[model samples]
Every structure is written in structure tokens, then in C-alpha cells.
Target: MNSFFHDENVALYRKLIAENESNPSRDEDRHAMLLTLLAEETAKAKQLPRLPDAW
Candidate 1:
């Protein structure tokens, strides 16, 4: 994979850690935003196509 893809994934991972550490549940808005982000990520993962010839 290219550096850009790897960078983006790393950035997303950092953001998730930050979000969790910040205790978003204390604030309704932040909690909702986190949920939205998680839902979007889940949807994107589900949309990825499977390879034609996997081992």
C-alpha cells in the first residue's frame, strides 16, 4: 500500500484514541459526534469490495 493510505489509517487510529481518552460521553454533542464517526467508518468498511482470488 502507498504511504498516503498508511498515513490516513494511522491518523484515524490516533483520532479514535484521542476521542476515547477525552471521555466524550460527558458531553452529549461530543458523544454524538463520536458515534457518527464510528458509524461512518463501519459503513466504509462494509462497502470495501472483496478480492476475487483470496487465499
Candidate 2:
């Protein structure tokens, strides 16, 4: 679950980077939204506790 969230956050950052590269002047509002999303995903990843198992 944590890995999933981490992957998603990385994907989002990549998307934002692509968009910014295409449109050199990205709006401040869009940047803020991306930052907020990244923060939320990071928090969620941190909150997830380690799981114990043997297979």
C-alpha cells in the first residue's frame, strides 16, 4: 500500500514536470495544487505502519 502511494506521488510529479516543460509558464494555482497533492501522499506513506509476514 505504501509503495502504491509512493508510486502515485512520483507519477504526479513527473506529470507536473512534463506540463511545466511544455508550458514554460505554468500557473501558480496549478503548482500549488500539485504541491498539496504531493504533501498528502507523503503523509499517507508515512502513516502506514510496517507489516510483518513470512511467505
- Candidates' C-alpha lDDT: 0.60, 0.73
Q: For model 1, what is the C-alpha lDDT against the true structure?
A: 0.60
| Residue range with the least summed lDDT across 10 consecutive positions in model 2 | 46-55
Q: What is the per-residue lDDT of model 2 for residues 1-55, given as tens digits with 9 covering 90 to 100?
A: 6766686786877688568657867887877777777777777777777565553
lDDT (Cα, 0-100) at 13 in candidate 1: 56
Prediction 1 TM-score vs. true = 0.46
lDDT tens digits, residue span 1-55, model 1: 3434544655685586577668745666665676676566655655666444555
Candidate that would win on lDDT = 2
Q: Lowest summed-lDDT stretch of 10 residues in model 1?
A: 1-10
Tell me how far candidate 2 lies from the true structure as C-alpha RMSD in angstroms: 3.4
